[model samples]
Target: MENKKRIPNWLKIIALLIFIIGGYFGWTAYTTFLASNVTDNQKYLYINTGDTYLQVLQKIKDQKIVEDPNSFDRAAKYQNYTESVKPGRYALTPGMNNRRFIGNLRGGYQDAVKFRFENIRLKENFAGKLAENFEADSITFLKLLNDENLAKSYGFTKDNFIAMFIPNTYELYWNTAPEKLFARFHDEWKKFWTKDRLAKAKAINLTPQEVSSLAAIVKGEALHKDEMPAIAGLYLNRLQKGMLLQADPTVIFATQDFTIRRVLNKHLRTDNPYNTYIYKGLPPGPIMMPSIVAIDAVLNYKHHDYIYMCAKEDFSGYHAFATNVAEHQINARKFQKALDERNIKK
Candidate 1:
């Protein structure tokens, strides 16, 4: 009987202590963490070139953006976001707890579709690749290029369509609209042909299309930036004298190879319009996606009266410009000697 009575008093004391402890914890939790309410306001967070987690936290706090970076980071750590932040723009929002925020930062978010072009060869190939990545009708894109009756929707010509695609990296939404994609390429092409570029082309009496063509030629010849102006000058001189450009890249574009053994009679027979060796002035359109540097080289080609040039044997990415056929022959012999020494099959 005495033991049972003693047990009740001790149980009462333990219950009272438990109630006091629970109250303390509840009060602190309410004051510290639960005081602020999470709203649905939009916010933005930036990750700079080289930033650490602590630095990012400080930035977040200093900007008065997120009130509790520790909790955010703690949740990030729980979700293993030690290095989840990517370098670019992101649209953020409030009411996103640390877990959801970190999850998104770690690429648990909507992915932006990607388009890339490095060294693609033809328009058909381009259409096919676009079809593969972007869910656009590849057959339709091909039909558009081929002038088939199935799809006559595209506004640009086959040649103009190829010219419009800027060869570079692009980020777009997943499953893009066809009209928007077409409009984007055309818009980008027009923007690239800015007012400054037009004025320069006007000075030379070259049309926008002609300048675009010249830019492509300049790109093909000068494999190195240092030789751009020199290569441009040689072609400009050829154009002025009404002489054939005789550029090997044009032939290579036709033959689709660097191997010709020589610029033989047969290689010239391949009838691709890019063959400047057989045909006149410039190719019908831009052969490759011209770089800004190549465009500038054509615009500001040296005023020198150089008429011929051959590759420098040193492969210093510079060429030996010649004023006449004799000097060009000498340089040409030197290049041939180097080729022979290396047993270059081309």
Candidate 2:
């Protein structure tokens, strides 16, 4: 009776084969196609705190960025990265696989771009150039340059104006808003001055802002980097003694033009507070972004009773300083002689 009821061994084998094949196909569909990094090309993934793996998966699917989340999950589980995702803004692209797309999102790669404001003086020049390059509407950039409201928002006093702006290289994304661009630079400036550097400035009775102003003066005085510290000392001595800084760079800042061959009498009387030749006490704010050399010079300036300085004839990146008017006159004459010999019209 048991032998008569026994099923054929071949039929059992065929049924088992069908079951194995079907299981294999179902597993592939669940892991490879249905579970994976599903990101919508058009949707933005905002990853802040408290986001879970399932929430992330749902977002990927809802945005239509991925055709299947099940495939992504299966792959992620296999790699043991199912719960190791990072939190930040993530950008997803089309046709991305589960592991590749999930990995980037978990890594938090933000979009960015490169830009520079180094050696730039005029506001409109920087604004127009950057705006045009970023397709941000040139007119809008120029308006920001001239915008008093924006100026005031960034700790600018009524008198500070554009002088508070620090010039340097920068990187930003194409979608970066105008306000963000301004704030980013400001933040960078704050971090640029280290704790030790800040202490050094404080020891010299100069705030970070004051140090920057002094650095700007050093920048205008020295044609060569080697001359910076010495020139910086001369100005510091003058400032300590209540003497006029009388820096030529101040005149350039006041005029908003750097082409002045000489510091004319009229330049001293300009309306801008940046004119150190006329106004006193650090010109109300920084005149320009100073290099590290300038800042160091101010912090470690050579102390001297001498209140006057002029360009040395040697142009060896050093200046010949003087203690009195007679000595100053001699030094000035020597510089003038060299200038004349070289046919420099100053």
Candidate 3:
């Protein structure tokens, strides 16, 4: 009389299966959106130019930054990131979820690279350094630097183009093209040559390029910043009196052999535009990438009547200045004797 209808066991089994499936889907959604899916290590991802979306995903997988690649792929797909790939250097921190990772790549937010160059002595070396930092190759950068037409478009000759790059720490993007890199350098040069700087250059009766040429010599001569102004002033004196610059640094550059520690008589006889000893004016280009300190020292050179300079006999990276040939000869003799004593015959 009280036989109640029992629920079917199959129905209960089916309901339990539905609950389990729903829980699994919910967990996947959470991991894809809100849960942390990356491993516990900070990493960096560089998406270079011409990299495809699949290649980028493969790179991420190779880095093992994400704990769940499936979720990340799904999230990236959902965000439509595959349609627009951006190239940049992205930093991947620990515990990053798929949403955060995909959002960063989609937004095209990248980090800046710190680039610095000093004592760069050749255009090839400069090109290689730039290639190491940017997306462009060394050959491409060198081509642009050596191209007469391209350099003229920027108000420079292939000879004096080195003056455009001021040696200082610059913040640049990793994927910057060769022309964009040149544009940035040109902009920096323009900013450096402010009205006040131009006035100072005018006061000295030297253009910016001429000042750079002299500054390069001063930089090559003096190792200490404290003596640059004095060296610059001495060279200015030489230029004012229409004397040969006779800068030993120019001889070393003209030889194209930086191994020459001492500029010998033969080195000075090199017949090149860069040989200030043979020529009567500044070299056609900078001997090295001059620093800002050297450039400014030239602009604010010490007012002295000394027209000749020889490195000190002590080898302490300082120099001796003389206003007359007799004093210069005496200083030169002392330095020569010191070199002889050290057996430094170039």
RMSD of each: 11.1, 8.3, 2.3
Flag the better candidate by lDDT, 1 or 2: 2
Per-residue lDDT for 321 in model 1?
A: 84
Tens-digit lDDT track of model 2 for 1-346:
4657878899999999999999998978655744544444664565445677777777666766666656776776776665776555455565566666656755656444557555544566667767754546667776776677877776554334444455655666555666666677668767776798889888888877778778877876777777677787888888778887888788888897777766667877887778877787687655655666667778877766777888789877577888899999999899888878987774
Poorest 10 consecutive residues of model 1 by lDDT?
148-157
TM-score of each: 0.63, 0.61, 0.93
Q: Top model by TM-score, which number? A: 3
Looking at model 1, residue 212 earns an lDDT score of 61
lDDT of 1: 0.69
lDDT of 2 at 213: 70
lDDT, candidate 3, residue 92? Answer: 82
Candidate 2: stretches off by over 4 Å: 1-111, 145-153, 158-169, 264-272, 315-317
Which regions in candidate 3 have their CA more than 4 angstroms from the true location?
1-11, 39-42
Candidate 1 structure, TM-score to reference: 0.63
lDDT of 2: 0.70
- Model 1 alpha-carbon drift over 4 Å, by segment: 1-109, 114-116, 137-140, 145-156, 258-262
TM-score of 2: 0.61
- For residues 1-346, write the lDDT of model 1, one tens digit per residue: 4654355778999999999999998865543343442234435565554567667667666765556655555555666667665543345666655555555667735356567774445667777877776656688567655552322243344454465666767786435665577667667767877898889889877776676677777787787886787788788788878898888777887887755645656788888888988788888777766666777888888888888888888877578888988999999999888888988745
